[model samples]
Target: MDATSRHSKILDLLNSQERVEVEDLAARFGVSLQTIRTDLRDLSARGVLSRVHGGAVRVSSAANRAYADRRKQNATAKQTMAALLAEFIPDNCSLAINIGTSTEQAARSLENHRGLTVLSNNINIINLMMGGEAKELILVGGTVRQSDGAIIGEDAV
Candidate 1:
């Protein structure tokens, strides 16, 4: 394709990654090193990217969050699961739940149900249920697992 298209594509790839190797780009786009170099040069001239050793980094790369840290970035799935779990809860009935992140999501989903008794070993679930339609919130007190914020031990059983 043309230089403009190639430059745009290079910018797109750079946007997706903090650093992209020239060899990988060359293979992905079926182009030679010289062609990739020319595109990188054009992007650099436009101040859209800075050419690093064997790769290019986007101008905004410094502000982008690393992929490893972004694994827990959005909790959209959790929120959706919470909302869906609301449907299974019957009003004024007692429900027993385990200690887990997903279980907390299920408890959060029950926010709209009225006069419901929720028994859980999850601190987050108890806290969330405190101000909602929960008629009664029973927390099986025990040692809380800090890693996942779940209560676990003999007391929780």
Candidate 2:
């Protein structure tokens, strides 16, 4: 397969197994060891995985996936949860939305709701609710996380 498709499959394998050996990948894909090494290096560069002695492992637990990547993963489930959350919010009320992909989905689901006020620390949520039916959108300011537009730090608390 082509490089992009191969990379996707490698990511899938990593997701399921949490790690992959270079030899196994080369044998499975009918490619050379160098090819698999290169694939691992590329994926590592993209922050998708970490290259080890004989293979690669998923990135560390301390680091979150890229915002776009996190948003795409379990997207359907997030949407469903957002829809359910929207059903519970009544009109002319207020809400405190947090940062993260799920909260973004929840904000999107609230676009049609009227007479509600939204309190959020996520810049994306504020942008989404702008000019909508919500009566007011209050952005709790602090340090904005460059990775996910999350306003955090002690000031936000």
Candidate 3:
């Protein structure tokens, strides 16, 4: 397969699997570990995935936020940050907000927007966005984390 196709496939796998090993991809794709690493590097550079010690993690704008505990620990700060960030987003735009407490706060901050499409993985965020004026809201499916209020696993794509 071409590099793009291969990268897409890799992303699909990473989205589905919590983690993937370099050797496994090399063996399954009949490529050398070096080639797999190169592909992973290119994909990571594009913000498609994050290179971890064992594998990669899918990258979403919401992925930039802190965990629920950290977010809740400073709810005021998160709310303030969300309010500030919300100012930069133009109306009637598509945005994929990841599943995290801070991102949830950000989503809540957008409640006044008239039209915005939000793709998310957090059920909590989705619940909040449902009450917003956004034109569209999409929840990426996968394993759900009740504690963190985010989704992770095979169905996230």
Candidate 4:
């Protein structure tokens, strides 16, 4: 298989198995150890995986992938949960939303709610609620996490 196809398969394996050793990848792909190492390096550089001493693991935990990947997973369920939560949030109330794909979805669902003061550390949520019906949108100041656009740090406290 071509390098692109091989890399894709490696990602698939990593997604399902969490981690893959260099020797195992080489054997599975019928490639040399050097080639497998190169693939791991490339994936790690792209922030798709984390290279370890003998193998590579998915960049994020088993329950969580990268932000973009997490956004695609359980999307329908997130929207449903967002809708349910939005219902409980009455108008003219203040809320602090945290970082996470589900929270971002919930913020989207709250776009039409009038007279809300939404405070958040998630840049995605702040952007989503901007110019909406909320009475105020407060973005907590802190260092922005490049991987997930989440504002986190001591300053955010």
The model with the greatest TM-score is 4
lDDT of 3 at 147: 68
lDDT of each: 0.75, 0.90, 0.80, 0.89
| Full candidate order by TM-score, most accurate first | 4, 2, 3, 1
Per-model TM-score on C-alpha atoms: 0.49, 0.62, 0.54, 0.64
Off by over 4 Å in 2: 1-63
Model 1, which residues run further than 4 Å from truth? 1-74
Put down candidate 2 lDDT per residue, 25-117, tens digits, no spaces: 999999999999999999999998999999999886434578888888889999999999999998889899998888999999988999888
Instruction: Report the Cα lDDT for candidate 4.
Output: 0.89
- Count clashing residue pairs in model 3: 2
Give per-residue lDDT, candidate 4, residue 75: 95
For candidate 1, write residues 2-33 as lDDT tens digits.
Answer: 77787777778776777877898888888999
How close to the true structure is residue 107 of candidate 3, measured as C-alpha lDDT? Answer: 88
On TM-score, who's better, 1 or 4?
A: 4
RMSD of 2: 8.6
Error of 2 at 85 (Å): 1.3
Which stretches in model 3 have alpha-carbon errors above 4 Å? 1-71
